[model samples]
Target: MSIAETASPSLAEADRFRATLRNHPAGVVVITASVEGRPVGLTATSFTSVSLAPPLVSFYIAESSTTWPALRRAGEFGVQLLTEEQSDLADRFSRRGEDRFAAPTAWSRGPSQVPLLDGASAHLVCSRFDTRLIGDHWLVVGEVTRTLVLDDPRPPLVYHRGAFGGVSALR
Candidate 1:
């Protein structure tokens, strides 16, 4: 039988997709927001820089995420580029139904009033500009109101194949 014919279940298809993505490496980031004076954060890998002139950035969030609603209402958010030592932090943020900011983590207020994570390779404090519905996710566009390079020499944490990986050395 062909590969498609041999695939018996939808679960198998999902597994195959995930297996395919294992080869594609991605940088880790924490997307944070303040909800009713309480902070919330989640780990994300689907982030990118959109522009330079107006300093735009974009990231994707699952539509079903509870955090997104509060973040959307807040009208501002922070992006923390994780470093090699932040694998545990990434795991913490990736979990659901947990107190994300309960643990001690270094953070400082940015121009947008969002909490910019300390020890991040970089931090972007942004104002939510627009959002577009894209299938099961929301494509959130933000205007970078402030930017900071926390550690220019530090390597960022990377994720691949459902596991943490170290950043590649610069060429």
Candidate 2:
């Protein structure tokens, strides 16, 4: 049967799906942008590279996100890949009703005035390429305009089983 014709999953099934996916690991990043001349950002594990030929990336933001209203207005944004050491920073941005760019948080403005988080393993400054409503979230696509790489040797952060962690070389 077609997806639209299928019955919606029960709440228990949905919870099971969420629990099952918790075993899968995902890289962490902070998506930032400036709106009304002020910095705004949020932690995201949905960030992923979509293409290499044209240097594109994509992430999903919930439609109910409080930060989405301001973030949607920006023509450009910054994506900072977090290191394992920045789990607190990740936790900070993921929270609600707080000044995410306060004194303790280090950051600077970059091209197009996008807010760039300091001490990240890498940063990607991107121009909004496309955005569309998909289910309950917006799928945002960006074209990379600039990239900054740090010399830090720390492993990139990842989230799995509802906890932040670093990876070890398999080989």
Candidate 3:
């Protein structure tokens, strides 16, 4: 391969790629897992349902994420769907070295010892199915063990163009 073909990507190119993806709106979720009974989680917009018979779900996390280290040790995880009103919670979880569980963030430990945040549109308990490295991120697949749905009909949070938003009916 030519030197240019094998060369590292430019920062501008990476930025442009990110910007392009921002145009495609994605649902937001907070991936929670336990490390020695302590809860850890991070905001992710890449969560997606991958299968039915196997009851699989998937999400992507950056390889450099500090939380991923502990989360990997977790045999299972909790995927909580956030509502548009929970934007502050999403922002807090995205940051590093702070108490994400503290302040306004309400949550309780599940029977499996995973932290389940309050007010989520939906919640799912998942067994660590598998993980694969893709580019600079890890694609995590989880097998859903249990699921919950709230009676409240709140609009789930969506991320687009570098901001948080909710859905609206076109019809």
Candidate 4:
């Protein structure tokens, strides 16, 4: 049988798969972009590095995401590596039908007019490299054009078991 034929569509299997991923910790990030002179952003835990030689990074956005339509049109975007203190910020961007860029968001425009969140541990400005539909989400790859590391020393925020947390460094 083909790979698709072997896939289980049962809700139990889906729950099991989600539970497995929940046990694995993931770094949290806010993906930001500007479209038609407006800033849009969302929280994501699926952001990851794809390459090093040419500096490529990637993140997956759901196909049903309301923000995807606008983000898909942008030529450039920003990725902010959140600190442990920015869990509220993460929650803010994750919600739907709310003004994510409203006051108290504390962000500014970066190169290519991408929205850059303030107080993040690091910021990466990227130009859109490739995008393709994969399963129920869109796989977006970007080429890093600029990187900014904050001088502040703080633990990075992480997501695990449906909550936000910080990690301790092992020396």
Candidate 5:
């Protein structure tokens, strides 16, 4: 622990830490995989590009996530970069024990059969590059083998301070 961490500890401090992180904006992402012949998915704001030369990206999943166990078994998955108009999808995918793909959730199988959600700003077909346990979450890095850029002109979905919003460029 850091010297400061060792000196004082309380739920107040944890709340402060959580709020501190919430203030930092993060791009929202959705992960999709076919587990045991069924589709599985979850929403996340932890996605980031890790490398350019090798085309790598990463996101973190909570260890307690009930969906992670099945998602891990799939050798491949799809990453969807959500647009501001897709918060409904983000909310749906974040929940547990529900049919996330139930009616009207437009999607189709990729060349490799990974379930890819339609209307995302971008879609990436990823194979496991690495996985590690960190704190209470799983850090997953994926090597992108294929990608698609949709022609949608909507702003990207962004999360900050517990709410979702879209970007407006500043002059």
Candidate 6:
């Protein structure tokens, strides 16, 4: 189904749905985009793989976010799947108006010409596909054009129940 065709639940229902969703562990990701050669990044835990065959993914950003507007205009963006050791980076990106890339964080260019954080569990370089206004947020769909995966073993950074957690294999 198309994003615009999807109906959103009520506010209370959405809140309850989010509460239930918190129980499902998700890998943290930092979405990056460049506006006028200036880079902006934001930490998001709502990212998900939409399709492997078509190499598609989706993430949600609050409509109130100032960052999303720039990203939406950028046309292309990068998603950096954070590792456990990158919690500090995640915290930095999550903050507003901070120099996100200030400290010594390794980065490289993605297909979007956006900075993809190094040492991440994975990276997906995508072009904007479709966006839909869903209640208080926007559901952004992207078509992955390139990807990077680390060879080193590392756990993912996870956010749950308003707290941070570490990822682990489900064995």
Identify the leading candidate in terms of lDDT: 4
Q: Write the per-residue lDDT of candidate 5 for residues 89-152, one digit (tens) a residue.
A: 9988987777899866888888578888878999999999999999999999999999998875
- lDDT (tens digit, per residue) of candidate 3 on 1-171: 776765556656888888888799998899998889789999999899999999999999999999989998999999999998999999999999899998778999885988999999998999999999999999999999989889974998999898899999899
Q: Which candidate should be chosen as best, given TM-score against the real structure?
A: 4
Query: What is the alpha-carbon lDDT of model 3 when measured against the actual structure?
Result: 0.91
Q: Tens digit of lDDT per residue, candidate 2, span 1-171?
A: 866546445656889989999999999999999999999999999999999989999999999999999999999999999999999999999999989999799999988898988899999999999999999999999999999999754799999999999999999
Q: Model 3, stretches more than 4 Å misplaced?
A: 1-9
Cα-based lDDT at residue 91, candidate 5: 88
RMSD of each: 3.4, 3.9, 2.7, 3.7, 3.6, 6.7
Q: Supply every candidate's count of residue pairs whose N, Cα or C atoms clash at under 3 angstroms.
A: 0, 0, 0, 0, 0, 0
Estimate candidate 5's alpha-carbon lDDT, on a 0 to 1 scale.
0.89
Error of 1 at 37 (Å): 2.0
Per-model TM values vs. the true structure: 0.87, 0.93, 0.92, 0.94, 0.92, 0.84
- lDDT string for model 4 (5-50, tens) is 6675566689999999899999999999999999999999999999
Candidate 2: misplaced stretches above 4 Å?
1-9
User: Per-residue error at 170 for model 1, in Å?
Assistant: 6.5
Query: Roughly what TM-score does model 6 have, to 2 decimal places?
Result: 0.84
Counting only residues 3 or more apart in sequence or on different chains, how many pairs clash (N, Cα, C under 3 Å) in candidate 4? 0
Give me the runs in candidate 1 sitting further than 4 Å from their true place.
1-11, 151-153
- Off by more than 4 A, model 4: 1-9
For each candidate, the alpha-carbon lDDT, in order, equals 0.85, 0.94, 0.91, 0.95, 0.89, 0.85
